[model samples]
Target: MGDVLRRRRPSRAVAPLRRDPRASGRFQRSHRRLDLRQGCVGRRAALLRWALAEMQRAFLGVDCGTQSTKVVLRDPATAAVIAVGRAPHELIERDDGTREQDPAWWIDALRGAVRDAVRGERFDIGGIGVAGQQHGLVCLDRGDRPVRAAKLWNDTTTARECADLTRKLGGDRRVLELTGNLLLPGYTAPKIAWLASHEPEAYARTVRMCLPHDYLNLWLTGEFLTEAGDASGTAYFDVRARRWCEAVLAAIDATRDWTRALPRLAPPLSVVGMLRREAAESLGLEAGIPVSAGGGDNMCAAIGCDLVVEGPAAVSLGTSGTVFAYRAEPAVDPLGEAAAFCDSTGGWLPLAATLNCTSATEWVRELFAMDHAEVDAAMASGGAAGLAFLPYLSGERTPNRPEAAGVFVGVRPSHGRDAIVRAVVEGVTFGLAYALDALRRAGVAPTEVTLIGGGSASDAWAQLCADVFDLPVARPAIVEAAASGAARQAQWAVEQTRPSLAPVTSRRFEPRPRRDLREAADRMAALREMAGANRL
Candidate 1:
């Protein structure tokens, strides 16, 4: 079978779920010339025209992902994406766990993306919502330009700083009490501390600090502001209070004037400001377009998955996997097992973020020198590895300490690369399931799962998730849910007063019987526990 056919041999339910005549015709017409593989979404007419007329007239959503920046023109009335555009981005790094990016490059990429998206279009793009890789700190000079490269979420250069912050803030208990999370090198506070102590001059010049998405919002509207969703990731914000905690700031003895450098907080859906004429001209957009206060990638992904209202949580497996459970009230973990934050939709989300996921799979594939063809072949051969692996190569993030790295135990020479590959896949799935368990413990038992991210492209991976999680995953008809999500946010932002602008379809995944699921779960639990014990 060809890759597409083999992968898309839809489940039995898919046949019955095929669109009725009217919807199918509309889809075909709206998406007439676009190919799915090349990121052709939002090209359909009813969807497109509705968006342009009602949504795109006022809002634009831009997502600055790890690999690309996607821009969408949306219609607020229908909450559809009229047009979409993307630009590439690269991650810089070193062996010492340093990953960074230039803030200027991010801006240029976004500008280029917006220009491409609206090149021939005539809609008046208004409120812009920017979403980007979370946990990255963008420090700025007094004039609001970057003083140095941003320290990304994946960068581990602040490990020592994380430890120092944990110690200074009265250990894990106190850290969780105040920040809703313990010190991790990936969060904002440790990065700030790392800069303050190591590069005082850069820190001194840093009049304000912003997360990656917030920084882009500043450039778009020339306003200093951020939403609660992004703010909670910074160790400085109090999850319970939903604002910056002065006590935490006092504990770190950060410069008394430091907080003033940051933008005033904006509600997630709040309209921050309109585009400046210069920004508009650079991006081929109209001046005075409204820009909504957007959110972190995870929050936006949840919105894309329709997890904003309620019901089963969504699982996003990109390079990293995040299991987000939404709640109307904040849920804190004093034990620091999960990271809880504010959702962009004025709710709380209990997040289980383990570094292991699609990244581990990619790393293992590369380590074995196996290309996409090899991985596909192995899966087609019913590849099953009796072996179990711990995919914490970059350290575990959720339900385990960030310092915990990946391990493949019980590797026998008899174990082939295929077995290793299967083990890696199962490992990440089980890790995510572990997070779901955490959510259940917190009294939010999800009834369904919305599977998303680039990793969702793989049939084998989705099947594995369904089997391991023992729950059907909702694979939406369209991919690029993040970009679509940003576009939807644009729709909502422009309307301002509308209720429930998101469109929904009845699509779902059902669990396939897997005899080995229970065994695999048991083994993964033992491995995680053993790893935890060794750390102490």
Candidate 2:
């Protein structure tokens, strides 16, 4: 891999989307070769026409998220989205700190989304890429069937395993030196440890361990491969070295034979394989189309927002909240709060992630029985004098607390519904602020933050984030940044050249004069102390 990197030329020029004007007309003429009188020939001609049409238009990007699967078709020349489609999936949450999802649903959702996205379109897709939720443990048996439901990043059932893995590896510092990350419950290594001990039968049957995107890649191309950015979150990969850390694997009690279960490492912009015949049929695409080795969602989002430089940073508000910056080289955190990850474009991504963000707001919206517009209205009318809320509903990661729960302090009879709603919104924003502080501690100073995700759609939330973080906040014109990034990555893989994607800001929220949030910050500190004192 190092040799490959040494031989490859670094080009900053974006790949030009290849277009052939006569290809479509020639493809249509080829159908004339088949006799329309025969039924079989007619069917064959139709399939051929579909395949040829797909080769002429744009690249495809699919984002398999925690709550939904989203697909986007983009014009390769301008990096502009042509069409989009989405399908939601249910998350199985248990009372005992368990979050799981069936892998089959992802396949179904992907096909459904692709079908919807390409409806009434006859253009050919150039290449395909996938950006999925990171740190998910997808275990497959020898027959390539899932052993059980995949445990998600937010699942907290592996706390004991995390601690045990750290102890086995000597200590936190040693573990960090080996993998550039501490053994957190959300990482893939600790989840594997938990499975080995808690469900030995399933562990024994497991033949391959893959991240969410890797599983999707396998379904698409019949290959087991992963890229650096997503692999870095596994706690079994060396972030700086860009390979699996054997020491970390040994510490987790994975024998030499078990290490074979890991996926092969591929470069982010390299084509891992061609689309399989069956998968192509299902997706209404060509069977021989190239499939790129895509990265984690955050890494792809960085590409979408054009955060390839050192100063610009981004905040993603989805199922999880993340504050990430680009670096020319690997940037490891001494405290292991900010993740040291590889970028999709062979750079570095230093980021801090929180477990709760828009999910907290979703809970609040359901609790109050208000639509998004009403919630925005409430935020507009409310002030910050009533109470403080802690948005740790699924525990936290940046603060490294796995057992903390959501809490609201200073609630009084005088507090109205608007106040409570505002508290929830403010709490989530504060969580992002804390993540930004973590990034700053790691020596990353961003001039401003580019906000993307579902929460960024709210004007109130954008202004509140700007005020709380004390930085200018800008939203991108592209709504599906991750999917767009995936499409860009696909083009890069096929062309072997990088595209210059400058972020186009739709709106900017400048910071306003605000009172000190020291009181709210202190409340957060006190809660952390309490959680520490009563560590589970």
Candidate 3:
């Protein structure tokens, strides 16, 4: 019994490090006993020197989303990400069709992300910038303290207010003409109207209304400001003029008691302010570190995906789907087919955002009891699902129709989960194509679309984008393109100079022949037409 628990001891044992100066260090002592390890210390010291040089020029980028906040530390010279960290936060859904989160929760999550990113040691951390969820309204009092939880973009409580705005603003035509978008519940105007009518006290206390990214920027730098892309989402920004819309503000006054709610416009790449002392300490960063007023999540992602050039767009299939086409100048459709948002690159970008993309696929997958990989393979098989899906699991944004519900037409008993899943994927892709067609109708066709997001990770899905969009779709190896875009903004803020946009390394997926894609897309168009007619 004693032998069973006893451990065997070697004839000689070597301890690790010795602090005594008289005694040789562990490596040296061990080396003297073994001659082959002599030069390793010098080599390690040289590598450490190189590493420090690389770290000195690194920039920090943070992306705040609905579910989590991601912090990325990148090396500017090589454009390589050195450190990545994420902090998860909670999302609360009220029974009243309202979705919101404590503004403090986002702040705390951001702090934790930064702290975790720079833990254990000091980092140069040249600059810091944020790319956060857009269209979410955060009200702040005169003291710059949050008055209440942030009303997220998905919140449907503002639906009635949004409808009122469309009517008061002279229908969708006036909204598109002034704000470069159709009236939507996700915009700041509707949210403000809802608060003014329902939460009058809170609305009266509000001194300034800011987007999510702006709120984080305020905490980091004590500055109240917003980036161009985010400002564009507020339904009060003049895309061509690059300023706040005075007309929209006045229009709201007639319908809602929003006398105090207004947002100031700032360029997406504008330098907001330096990091505050408390923020600096928490992030393990030096005080006064440059913090750029980064743009909305999608716009920053466009920058991250390197979609600065005209023609080529970036397609993000996140919780929501978006096809963002970079333009050298402002582009607005009178028909309200697409939105003209301010790009982080200091220009205008026309965007078409679908309320749901991957979220739609996930719903169908769960409903059918099929895993992602299995469904993805079937979709890539190029077999027709004999079905068409509208992919409106939530609702619609671009094209400005929310009543458009998800549809699974042409379903038959022979079809299985694979066919249904393929239809969902194809349906979302077709929705994207519909937006692309709008871009083309406006006389601006994308040369290519850079696919970035969770959907792009799957080869089958990437091929599907290529097939459905009928153009080359590029994907990047970098997972956090949005965070990288923020890092790029930070790098520009601190460098005392701006760098020219250069194409970064990325993989391309050229369109391949697909007979089924055309058929599926045509079916989707017909279904969309029927749905549109039903709404009318």
Per-residue lDDT for 1-536 in model 3, tens only?
A: 11321222111111112246566587456546444434766556455555565544568899999878999888887777878877888988865667798888877677667656665444676778799888898998888888999998877678789888788878887778777877788778888889988999998788878899888888898887776787888887887888778788877665433434454555565677888888766554567778887888888887776777787877888888887878888888656677778888688888777777888888888888788778777777766558777876566775555655677788899987677787888888788788877766555677877888777888888877887788988787775888888888888766756565544546777888878777777787788777778742
> In model 1, what lDDT does residue 201 have?
90
Please give the TM-score that candidate 1 achieves against the real structure. 0.84
Candidates ranked, most accurate by TM-score first: 2, 3, 1
Residue range 1-536, candidate 2, lDDT tens digits: 22322233322112223446667875555555554534566677667555654544688899999999899988888878988988777799987789999998888788777767876456567789899998999999988899999999999999999998899889999998998888999999999999999999999889889999999999999998899999999999999999999988887775646557889889878999998888876666658788999889999888888888898789988889999999998888888999988888898899999999989999999998999999999887745574888888998897888888888888998888888898888888888888888888777988998999998999988988888888999999995888888988999899888868676789999987666465676776676677667742
Is candidate 2 or 3 superior in lDDT? 2
Off by over 4 Å in 2: 1-56, 254-259, 516-518
Which ranges in model 1 have alpha carbons more than 4 Å from their true place?
1-58, 367-377, 380-383, 501-507
Give the per-residue lDDT of model 1 (tens digit) for 456-506: 767777777777788877776543566656656665766665355444643
Please state every model's RMSD to the true fold in angstroms: 11.2, 7.8, 9.4
**What TM-score quantifies how close candidate 2 is to the native fold?**
0.90
Q: Give the lDDT of residue 460 in candidate 2.
A: 87
lDDT score for residue 521 of model 2:
67
Whole-model lDDT values for every prediction: 0.74, 0.85, 0.76
- Say which prediction, candidate 1 or candidate 3, comes out ahead on lDDT: 3
Cα-lDDT of candidate 2: 0.85
**Candidate 2 or 3, higher TM-score?**
2
